[model samples]
Target: MTKVRNVGGKITETTKGNDNSFAKENITYNSQKKISFTSDKGIKHGKPETLPPPELPSKCKVEFRPSKSWQGEFGFDWCRIGDSQLPVDKPYSDIVGKYGAIYATSPSAVFTIKPELYQRHLAEYEKFVLSAFGTYYVPNLSLMKGEIAVLDAAIEIKENPDSMYYKYDKTVFEVKILEKLSNTKGKHFNDKVLEIKCLKEFSSKQKIELIATKNKIDNKIGQINVLPNNKVKEIDILFIPVEHNGSSGTIKGKEITILTNALKQAYVKGNIVRHKEKIKVGGWWYDLFFTKKDDKGVVSMETSNIRSIHRALDDVFFKEKDNEIYKNHYRVYMLTNSTSLNGMAEDIGKNAKVVVVYNNRNDSTAPHELMHAMGLYHTFDNDGLFTYKFQNTDNIMDYTHQVGKDRFSTNTWQWKILN
Candidate 1:
């Protein structure tokens, strides 16, 4: 039988009937009697005694030590690599030893750490600390679910692809910290302070600015200001489906596909295509979500009676919670089987826009509601009583009951407002 020896608090073992080296490097074993090597000196085992924890350094260090022990509950809230943080769900051990020697441990996994491992960990850990103290975190990595950006640490040295690389992923972010904004129980966590701007649904003006910046980058312009031209661009549409009884307005059967095709057809039928072959592919790319229902599986439509239904869904489903992170996407609701008015598009709060339409509409409904979302008002003037002008039937914003072919003609002011 092999006897176990205690070298300080570290446990070591030797092979039976063999006086030689241990299975682990740097450890020595003996046969007739158990012996362990400490710093190339053989030492015999005695009664195990617990030693006091090692003292922590005033500042972090990089060199490894052999004689000293380490103390304190050193752990990291997150681990940053390149511009992204590894999705470590649990608190990770970040033990610091004498002379600031560091070692990181995880509850679920182990890493074959090199001598320089702690150096990288320390660098990333410093970024996390800065973010915890409220630093700007601009990440180049795509974010995960329930995660939000915290801060980024600037690196003086430029990274080379071959030497500095993550083994698992293609690219590693320099440093980024992120935290779950809400827990599984749907409770908000204020301590996880992170800011990310790209996920926001930008306005048309903001989108123009983004396009201008991209143009500046592409053209390699040293000193220039970019301005967007007056051309219709593709818009992102997040289609939140609110069905009363598995049907929207009056349209039933395959909500997403049918509605998508109908919307496409409406735009195509309106003769908005740029050319024959250069058809707009992402003219209205969408992400769909079903309406929230009660325990009885019935969707309540009464705004007065079922306010919670609206409130809960509105609170949860938004651009901020978007997993795909679409830029400048508009959140519109396709509320089905409504017994009320046809459709409405208005602002809910500051910088918040919502467009809702019932299902009983034709192909033109989606475009009409979309025009409202894009800042277009009805053709009929509504000073007190709605008065229809001669141009009302000639425009897409005209009332549905009007008697003429509707075109997508907008005045100069209207176009300026839309863009």
Candidate 2:
């Protein structure tokens, strides 16, 4: 490989090979005269017994450099030659034309190299140098440890002032190579069903029974049955109060009331019944089966709420808005601790979605959380918009109850879930 060094001392690698077995020769003329050529083997066996000669003008000079590739199977070898500086009016073609014969050519059709052709060859050389060393002109190309190579080259120049003499020179090149790697992986998930159990104290108070009264528990259970494959199976909620009014008890009377009332509100007013039928719910410590055989298949989800209960709600309630197949078959969950939004749905559990709010809060929190549960991301997350700052305070996702913020913008990332 060819190694090039840049002005900044950076080295670049090229695809060219390192073999350099070449030579150069020069020819000069004092007066107008034709020139001849000869093969490296010094054998002149062609169609014509005598070869034609080239007409060289007065005071003209020429230089020649030949290069060959060791790996070349065909005629990939090439040569570069330069002529002495002459007036524009000089007829230089006549001189090189004769030299073509010596190099093996016919008299009637002598080959002559043009000035433009020479310029093109020079350009190619410059490009090769830049590619190998990283820069064409610089302070000096830097040579790395494994890049040095000895080259066998020659430069031939001919002048016209007096008897012309040819000059030859040799040079070496050092190169280096660099490599880089990148990583790009998307999102993924493994299980589907989310197991949940009610806090022990809440369950002991017959919270499920008390909540059932708000909207006829039997009727809601029937509605849950309507769900395909009885996707949502409710395991008896068991609540264990880790902390109760700074006292320890199997079941506290006041705690039961609070638990029952919370359940009632969550089921009746909060519309938990509709979701129960569509999602599978298990006791807090129950074994969750999230395999393909389960009614709720593989689920894709994201979450900020790490609480087990909230995660369970997400699996049971969330669905994607537009994803028809997975939305209909699987369950997604977005566990959130925010009390601003209670829960949201997209066609219920028919699509992959989220359940934003987890902490018990005011009624308004349900809608907001549900909005997120319905597969709606934050409104402020405008990914590629140059004008929008990702963490800006004005964004709706950043809005807090203290600010009395409760509005969804039409031009927000949240809209993507709907479409």
Candidate 3:
């Protein structure tokens, strides 16, 4: 049987087969055009991005780069490299040319940004999500791990008239690549290791200059930045367009920030451990199924006496065998345009998967509702009254927002559900 659903400005169609298999298709719309792509597992396309990248660069050179997936194949989820968690429903400002970077969305396919949506994505969106760095995912221009980045005409070799036999010893293409973040695997790639291939080929003039300076006075990229997971991120690499083509012939350009996917943490309240890792999470499989949008959508708990958004979601999250799907990991069912993120839990004896809704507006309620699924409750439900105490101010399950505090801390006693 085939079922169609429309929610959150997107359309999802699911089909179940006689053999008990499932296939889902998602359709999203843009005002000017519609862009679509596929993935092995469904993605939560429009979640708010709260985690930010490191302040410094993670430059790894050819010798130090990892051998597993150098080209960001695995979890390199930065927007520039490819799989950024950019919200799809936002307005894309198209302000650039046709030649933009096309990155791998899957091993078999890559997502290419249409030219109209180029600069808006590369410039504005990149900046909005980043405090520093411009989007530098352009191929050849965007150097990956193990890729040697050099300023073509940005830095011109100048003559050092004071030094004998060192005519054009001034810094050039190599100096920037050695120090600047061509790749940020989080190591300092700039101690100036000679690219083995060309060392012997250096003329006596270059050799004399190299031996004189050694490592004393070369370009400096300062220190490397590491992410929350204790690994240097490639997306944090920064490369300036300073060509030693000539001293006076320098070109003006913006800093191209490399992008990588990393999870962010809320340090004060470590309860949200999911986003604490700097490394991207892969295969922690979960799907976001949407219930049809309604004028009323899902009722707001603040206004409504009682609403069973969870039960509504469980009814349609999947029509086929429910136990088979949500057995291992719980599923998130979004009630698009809903005013509430609250939902009920798996009803007793229903064997249904726990369903959680996304408040298309305020997302603060998600973690709280998930806490319910993890077996938490209001401070107390005694006498049918939701309990409140000064201690409950930090509890995610409490109505702490009423006290003008947006808190996520949970008392140790309430966290026993995880064990």
Candidate 4:
């Protein structure tokens, strides 16, 4: 076992059984991006592998992939890569020492982190944090479900009083000190003063939680929770993104900024919609890039005719399905100009080319359209395979997002048919 302690601001790990030299290298792992090792001291990993395709019920379907972006000669470009993580409907260790340092060199390292899926990973959260808090959660409930962001995060520098932060997946400062690892749970969690720092202000936004606390807590911040275990099976999503038609260029500056934050916020809203039992639908990870480039085959068009949009996307996505993109990736688009349709994803569409969307749409656009591409018929549509008489209009499949209570959930009867 390796003991992790903070030597000043640097993280130091001391091991007992094998060679303890892996901790001495100058390695950097950003909480927002991913945990990686430099070539000098890390184990040699084969080329990254992606998650297998999802097997949807004969009645419904979904898949996984990641959006890998890099700078190219033509400004910015993107492609698909293997999704790094997925949500497991199980409990995790709360021991802070049971986190990242021990398996620092291993590829299967797991940390109970609080992750935020940042728009373009390196993008700071000053504006987004302020806006979202102002819009949805200023003086909100004291304790709520923490699984809104796409992935997890950890602050390597605990002492730096920065104005921004990467999203944390598991840690809970309750907006104050992280006492979970210092002592036992009873004493740490009982302090109401910590929880009341709820709306504490930072440079531009109110902090939801602090990264780590001082003293013997080891300065490590990660939390993992075992849920109410009502689940029997699991399905993983390798959520991938692809762009076409110079789609990212449609909006500039604030248009992009506001829309980008809205999409991320929408994604957080989408995360709340899940099948907690029998089937746990999860696709929590995504990537947004600083540069927006189109896929080679995606045609640039101006009009919003749904069929024309689908055709332009289908031809390129289908033609290059094997290499540049995959059938599992959910393709996203943006255009120089758009019309009445906020976004579009075809119904009961089997292939990847079957579903596509313009990202510059409203905040409520994604999960609904994504479900269509994933083989779910609208609840009100007569062609659905299962009979579902929803008692209310809060279903995600319906166009009821204006109320902000729509959920991507189904009735017990619908669950039975699909499960």
Candidate topping lDDT? 1
The lDDT per prediction is 0.32, 0.25, 0.28, 0.30
Q: Name the 10 consecutive residues with the lowest summed lDDT in model 3.
A: 254-263
Q: By TM-score, rank the candidates, best first.
A: 1, 4, 3, 2
CA deviation > 4 Å runs, candidate 3: 1-312, 320-325, 339-353, 383-392
RMSD of each: 25.4, 37.0, 29.8, 23.4
For residues 36-123, write the lDDT of model 1, one tens digit per residue. 4364566667744433222221111111010111100011122222222222111112321112122111133222323353343333
Which is the better candidate, 3 or 4, if ranked by TM-score?
4
lDDT of 4 by residue, 1-419 (tens): 56665555656666676643233335455576567555467686464443322221121001111111110001110111112121111111111112333332234644342223212221211111221112111111111223221112211221322232223322332343222222222212121122221122122212342233333232213222211112222222222234332223132233322222222222211122111111111122011111222576433333334555455544544554353433344444433334335666754556433444444555435545655665556554445542122212333454444444323333222222222
TM-score of each: 0.29, 0.20, 0.25, 0.29
Cα lDDT for residue 231, model 1? 39
- Given candidate 4, what's the lDDT at residue 258? 28
Off by over 4 Å in 2: 1-283, 286-351, 362-376, 379-396, 412-417
Please list the residue runs of candidate 4 whose C-alpha ends up more than 4 Å from where it truly belongs after superposition.
Answer: 1-305, 317-325, 349-353, 385-392, 402-419
